[model samples]
Target: MATLMAVMVFGGAAALALYALAATVLPQASRIAAVLRGQSGNVRFEPLSSLVRAERRIAVRRWAAGSTMTAAALRPREAA
Candidate 1:
């Protein structure tokens, strides 16, 4: 029981420390991101729809190519 209590206390302290660290760091991260966005002339943050669409298209093409290759490999070859 004592060991379990000690573990709980230490784990709680560690979690609190991590929370404090993120609280201090996130604002700085956001500021840096805003600066980069400003320099790139993008006034607003856009959703990732276009990027996701492009990735899906690439993935579909790769799947089709792989399926074609596997089908060809499994086909019986004629003997000469």
Candidate 2:
């Protein structure tokens, strides 16, 4: 029973250590992959930019409709 308990504790510690290492490394690995792909012109920015713009438009519309947290009052007026 004591041997079994020691083995379980050691396995759990090893698993936790592996998880911590992966959490630190995976994001940096993904970013490096993105940069490498971008260098080959495979990364597209327009879709992301358009999505951001659309989200902003939605937020502005929501604000104009009197949703206080969306900052509708901060939207600039369009000139006639």
Candidate 3:
């Protein structure tokens, strides 16, 4: 019973220490440790839709390269 209690207490303390380190120390450490020179004043990221579209194009190109059948052959026939 005593050993179990000691283990639980120590485990909890260790967890708290780790959480404190991540929550408080990590962000400041990154900001302080790195020195940056400004190259661009504005930073713009590509929209999610555009990124997904680019990835889809890449996948289609890969599929086309690997497959023996042409894309037109893979399409379903039109109903009469």
Candidate 4:
């Protein structure tokens, strides 16, 4: 009975994970693969220099316990 219960719990979790991936990533990944392919149908790999870039780094001691994020909002010209 324990083995059966464990299997049911993990299986449901795995199904939900796969569903999330299929919903979010699969469409964008297909477009990226198509863009990277060459005329001969092979994937033309790019060098790391082109793929990765350095961003402005912030020095942080530690992360806070919770996440609170902000988004850039648009207003009328006079608001700025």
Candidate maximizing TM-score: 4
| Model 3, residue 65: C-alpha shift (Å) | 78
| lDDT digits (tens) for residues 8-47 of candidate 4 | 9999999999999888988677666766783344456667
User: Estimated TM-score per prediction?
Assistant: 0.37, 0.38, 0.37, 0.41
Q: Give the TM-score (vs. native) of candidate 3.
A: 0.37
- RMSD of candidate 4 to the truth, in angstroms, is 17.2
Candidate 3: worst-modelled 10 consecutive residues by lDDT:
34-43
User: lDDT order of candidates, best first?
Assistant: 1, 2, 3, 4
lDDT by residue (1-80, candidate 3, tens digit) is 99999999999999999998889977766454543443344444669979899999999998987788878878899899
Runs with alpha carbons beyond 4 Å of true place in candidate 2? 32-80
Task: Please give the lDDT score for candidate 1.
Answer: 0.84
User: Candidate 2 vs candidate 4: which has greater lDDT?
Assistant: 2
What are the runs in model 3 whose C-alpha is more than 4 Å off? 35-80
Question: Can you tell me which runs of candidate 4 are displaced by over 4 Å?
Answer: 38-80
Alpha carbon lDDT of each predicted model: 0.84, 0.82, 0.80, 0.62
Clashes of 3: 0
True-structure RMSD for candidate 3 = 7.8
